[model samples]
Target: MAQQERGKRSRRSILEAAARVFDERGYDAASTNEILARTGLTRGSLYHHFPSKQAIALALVEAHGEALRPPERPVRLQSVIDLTLEFARRLQSDPLLRASVRLTIEQSSFDCPPRTTYDQSFEAILALLQEADRHQEVLPGVDVQEAASTIVGSFTGLQTMSQAYSGRADLLERIGIFWKLLLPGIATPGLIGHLRTTLPDD
Candidate 1:
């Protein structure tokens, strides 16, 4: 058990180091040597866990998908909103999440096809919207699938702008405004009234 736990920790360290390097240097410019240096792990150890940089990037994408799994909430639409807000918070601070976004964009250059990461995000949101539809929380005439796509697209654009302009310091605020603008058009009146645009503390 101890040996297995140690192996998990070592793999985690490698992935995290790789995320930081990728987030800083981008996929094309990031080097395995830099990842090794960041983890303080030997070449042999890294190869034992991840055979190639492509493998590391794929693993990071998988991790990002897992991170997007939001906690279940009674109000499904609220879950969707909360998930986006939480993602913005993590994008502001989590190197793994930030790196995942970069890897998804740069995967084509590295011969790693980027479909599962984004598809998973889309499917998750679609499922939430469908559930909200069943609950009558969605406004009349709102197409659940289309609404899901719009939410994801809007968040992605806003997040990219936040990254470019301020390193995401204003991300939560922008995300809040995003929800405020979107909810009125998609959510039922009662649901929209209860939904929060700002983070709870704000």
Candidate 2:
């Protein structure tokens, strides 16, 4: 148990370090040596866990998503908007997530990213949309599967862009654009009105 715990800890450290390095230097310029230096680990330690720098970069992407998973599903459209805004806020605040987003976009790694953990992020959001359908929260005309796929797909694009442009001052505006464009079409008329009313006046 102790060994397993230490291994997990070490892996997390490496991932966080890689995120920092990637954000600071970008992927092509970041070296495994620099990543290891950030983690305060030897080459052997890094190699013992991640076979290569790409693997570490991939792990960083997963870690980035993992750090941002929401605790529970929302009951209403307003909550959904709030939830997304909160997610965008979290992404803006976390450097590791910012780096991972950049890594994912630069690699163009969607449909699949470098790590399996990223799939969990997909599933998490997909599950929310699915649950919304179960409750008939999604607009009646929208196809649930299509809605699920579109929302998930657009979010990937948005997250990729958000991460790629992490330091840009208008990050919130970018996120707002995604929602404004998407929600009008996805939500039922009543739900759309709800969102219009509930989204923080901005």
Each prediction's Cα RMSD?
1.6, 4.2
| Residue range 1-202, candidate 1, lDDT tens digits | 9999999999999999999999998988989999999988999999999999999988988888876787588888889988888888989899999999888765446654557656778988998899989999998899888888888888888988999999999999998898888888988987777877765664
TM-scores of all predicted structures: 0.94, 0.71
Per-residue C-alpha lDDT of model 2 across residues 24-63, encoded as one tens digit per residue: 7778888998888788988988999999987877666666
Least accurate 10 contiguous residues by lDDT in model 1:
105-114
Lowest-scoring 10 consecutive residues by lDDT in candidate 2?
A: 108-117
- Candidate 2 global CA lDDT score: 0.67
Task: Say which candidate scores most in lDDT.
Answer: 1
Q: Show model 1 residue runs off by greater than 4 Å.
A: none
Residue pairs of candidate 2 with colliding backbone atoms: none
lDDT of model 1 at position 52: 93
